[model samples]
Target chain A: MKLMRLLCWIMVFCIDVHVKAEETHKEKCDFNRGNCVILAEDGRRVFRSDEILVMLAPRALLEIRNENTVQLVKGDFYIETEQPVKLQTPYAKIWCEGECKGLFSRTAVTLEVKSLDGNWRITRAGEKTVYVVPAGLQVSIGEVAENGQAQMEFPQSLPWVPTIKQWASLYPGKVSEFKPELEKFRQVWREAVEAVSVLHQTVATRAVASHEAEVEQARRQRLAQLREDQGLRNLFRDKNP
Target chain B: MPLILYMRLTSFLCFILVMMLGWMQLYSRAREIFNGTSEIKAEIGHLKSTTAHERIAMALEREQFLEFRQNVATLMPDVLKSKGLGEEGYPYRSLASSISRSEAELVRQTIAKTLFERAKDNFRQEKFPKAIHGFHQIIDHFGFTPYVADSYFLLAESHFKQNELEACTGVIQEMVELFPHHELTGFALVRLGRIYQVQNRNEEAIEIFKTVMRSFPQRDVAAQAKASLKGIDL
Candidate 1:
């Protein structure tokens, strides 16, 4: 009898260990947002979009149309997946088929695949038409996305980030009374005041102008409805340049 | 008689031991079920709370961005027309450059502010090209000025108003990324989504709206995004 009781206790112990192991192996992602840091063997992905359906099981499947390689929905995503992260839309399927980092966005006319530091793929849905978008390059799919034009729009934008960095150099540290000859300090404070007061005055004037423009627009609409409208000619009063 | 009683007592003891063992197994199974259910429930509660928190924060951020834009729109004219400090005039940096270094800094600020306001006013009055030029001046020459963020946004807005969708997309993307965590970022993201919708890229629009709903679930923008999603065919 004692031997049988001991055997039953051992069985329960084994079952509990198996259950705990299963919980750890199965990846069940939380559907709610609050500083979610997606961790994989290789790297991490921080989500900033409002609507994303991320499933970690069976290869981290995001929402995509099953009928085609193309996705029915497209939102901005920054991915650094351990394996390749594939994005399917109705028009095309984009994947960092290579190991790397990238940000993908879709617009009204195009699926813009911006490979920040990796080689991404753009394959047309229902067809094997593929475009290899290399590192530091952008590829678009749609009416505006031509075969060769993607390479021409290089050095894509102004130095917005660098510009902010340079601006930060002007920041003056906290000034104490002992630090009297702080010319830069005084200067920073002065400009801040000037900015506030001048901006306030500008906003007030704009409000008044906006109100006046609205009244004028309404009056013009009334007149146009009564007579034969000449359109562009009516809105334009040519002034001396 | 004593031998018969001994056998019966032994059998009764064996039955009691078996029943106790069976009860232990049942209790263990019940405990496991109860623990697993509670764990799942705790997770669900955490997720619901987190989503609610995200929604409230997003709403507040969006409201703040709108308020700032409206005030700045009205303030543009006032800044442009402000008379320089009577004789302590800081018109262009050219005059201040000849003076002390500190004076030059003041002149630069004044000039950048003046240029930004003029460009913004031109935007309000529907003068797209000139507005673009003025905004670029603030970005190029006075990158350090407080006007940089506003200039970037207005520059994109000017392009958008001019029907330069391509340029608008790029600039708004730049704004959203370079100024992450700023209130303007929310507007930029939403505007980007709308641009996609207008261009008939409903799938992309849906994706954007979904992201907004997930990240800022409690916001009116999220609700608007839901409406947008429903309004779209898919």
Candidate 2:
């Protein structure tokens, strides 16, 4: 009886160890949002136009067909399509196997779908322009204007400029003591820019005047004085000549 | 008569022993079932809480980003006009460069705030992958912002949520390595030790929990760690 009880205890201990080992192994594979198991039935699952799929696979060529539209979030496998595909994102790089028909949001998230056929036309809103997306082209959202000009655009800049009051609060001084000096600096800067604008406008408007030479000379003189007042010695130092 | 009495006593003692052992086993089984059910419920609650928080946070971020875009759109035209350029002729590259550093600082703060919110919400939602992605985005885009330490904490939480407890160990391990003096370090360490406990890796859990108690004696996490150590029974 003693021997039988000891055997039973050993068996229980072994089972417990085995269960823990299994749990640990299960956790190992489920680490990377690998939680979802896509079954064969998922292939037939129809996703709606607004449904976005972020493919986790590094190298997957997903073949998705939609009657409406789809947005592929960043870090998804590229889509290869035979039909014209309309992709909307800040930008998209799609490869078309057949006719490429799609609209892209002109915002930074533009659709760049590649096509097997070299013939393609890009329409921004209503403006349609015939263009060739080479067999393996990667196009961004914006159009390269005529003359092959690329307009370099920056991302949205910052908002909420620190007011003089806001800046003063960071320091140990009272607002009354600080505001006047800051305001004076701002006013001086504004006046200096206005003086430059006035000179430029005068030069532009007097171009067809009979006293054009006189206007030009006066504009130069004014620019020189304005530059001096603003302590911009390099700007109009030679204008005295 | 003596033999009969001795036999009766022995039989009585045997019966009592069997009854006591049976009761002990029953009590142990009940305790095991209760503990197991409690853990399952706790996990379920964590998932539900995380989902709700994450949805709200992501929506908030998207709204804020859109607002930022609109504000920039409205202000850009004015800046372009001041520069003597029509919308088409705007020297965008130059104007962008001329934007003051303080302006960039403001944008960074907003982005950081949004990223942190998304990360924390995802962590709460038990969506570890999404939460990790959010933290990575914060680290990638808002690396210069004040959200770095918080991002690390969220990343650790994300890994923990997925039951990638081992993977989580490495992340929190890195967190401690990277942010040695971070205010939340003890909390993270205690949580990491709990992951070990959940896996029945009691020795490692006890070691780490003890370390937390020693290192962060004044912190509440340390107290929790001490309480957790009581369960290890070693």
Candidate 3:
């Protein structure tokens, strides 16, 4: 009787664990059809979950892995999230946090991540070092090098960002609702650029002041050493006489 | 002692009688259950056999019907011509009514398709008048076929090729009213706008081009409209 009771408890525990595991990772979207198009009313194929909102561009293939994770198989995607979300591409993985909005594009040879309004942490596949990309900057990870290294490019200012008018023109039917989101993106991008510029200026000013101080201290030390040398020469001359 | 033996014997006889009665009742119940099961099994067998036979018969019937449709389809054009029956004539109508509706539709589609091909060939050869006649015939008599939209568009093109701007516009407007959602409507609108441009009606042309661009944003229709707009701007 004791053995049977123990077995029953073990089975119950296993069933509880299985149910918890299932609850933790449930698929939010299943878009396996070729090059998913926007058949919904919004003129964009959007997948919304508790953690992130993903908008796929024309002919883009994307799959939501779970609530907070998405895989970009090909083409472009724009993502908005208040919480942390993981974006997986063929060449790299990007972790976005803190009310972030970003555009991610992948192709056969490269994966490009543009931080439109918030910070993004990017790590190339098989690489350990994470590169933090601030808003208004973009990064591209190219095909792996022949020597088994990621060809990670340095972050730079976003070359071109689509305007609200252009996006509205592309999806004319949903212009009313789309315009406000794009306007907010523009405002956030402008603030981020200004913030980055001020930070750069402050760091430059501090570096210049520290360099000047170091130069002044070195000159004074040289002058003191010269005086001591002159005094020692005079004492030697007197003793010789 | 004898009276005790007699009592024991009578008790044994009564017990035997009860055992026999119980066995008889049990046997009757078993026989009833077995008979009921066999009856159900026989009914199931009959249903299975009938279904199999019906399926075979249906397959053979479908094959024979397909053969008959093929023969009728091959002979339909000659029969119509020999009977001196036009497509919309009462005699042809009566003949079409004699066949199944699907078969009649198939015949109409074949005739319309052949007419459309001939008209397209004429248009390609720059025989505008002949092409217009053929397209008009298709539109008038075989309008129910799927080639009507193509016929209308080609008819307008024939008019445009002959520099008959008014006729071209009239045909295009009619087509738009008839087939509002057809893809060719966008192309026809672009053509109409081009005619307007040729007539030096810039404002009207621009409006038509803008309409095309707004209505068919992702298609070649929009691209052509954009090109026309650029030309006007220049």
Best by lDDT: 3
Q: Write the per-residue lDDT of candidate 2 for residues B1-234, one digit (tens) a residue.
A: 999898778666655665666667677768868779757877899997688557545643553453344334334545555663656554653444333234457766887898789778877877778889889898888877888888877787777767677777887888788877666778888887878878888889889988888777566777788888887875
Residue pairs with backbone overlap in model 3: none
Give the runs in model 1 whose Cα sits over 4 Å from its true position: A1-241, B1-85, B88-99, B213-230
TM for candidate 2 is: 0.30
What is the C-alpha lDDT profile of model 3 across A160-235, one tens digit per residue?
4453333343432366777676777676667666776786788879999999999999999999999999999999
Candidate 1 deviation (Cα RMSD): 29.5
Per-residue CA lDDT of candidate 3, range B1-234, in tens? 999798668656655555565567667768867779757878899998688556545543543453344334334555556673665565754554443345457777888999999999999999999999999999999978888999999999999989898999999999889987778998999999989888899999999999989887557888989998999999
**TM-score of each model, in listed order:** 0.29, 0.30, 0.32
Give the range of the ten consecutive residues with the poorest summed lDDT in model 2 chain A.
A39-48
Q: How well is candidate 2 docked (DockQ)?
A: 0.01
Worst 10 residues of 1 chain A by lDDT: A143-152
DockQ of each: 0.01, 0.01, 0.00
Please list, in the order the candidates appear, how each scores on TM-score for chain B only.
0.53, 0.55, 0.58
Q: Model 1 misses residue B154 by how many Å? A: 1.3
Model 3: residues with Cα > 4 Å off, grouped in runs: A1-44, A160-184, A191-241, B1-234
Where does model 3 sit among the CAPRI classes?
A: incorrect
lDDT of each: 0.55, 0.51, 0.70
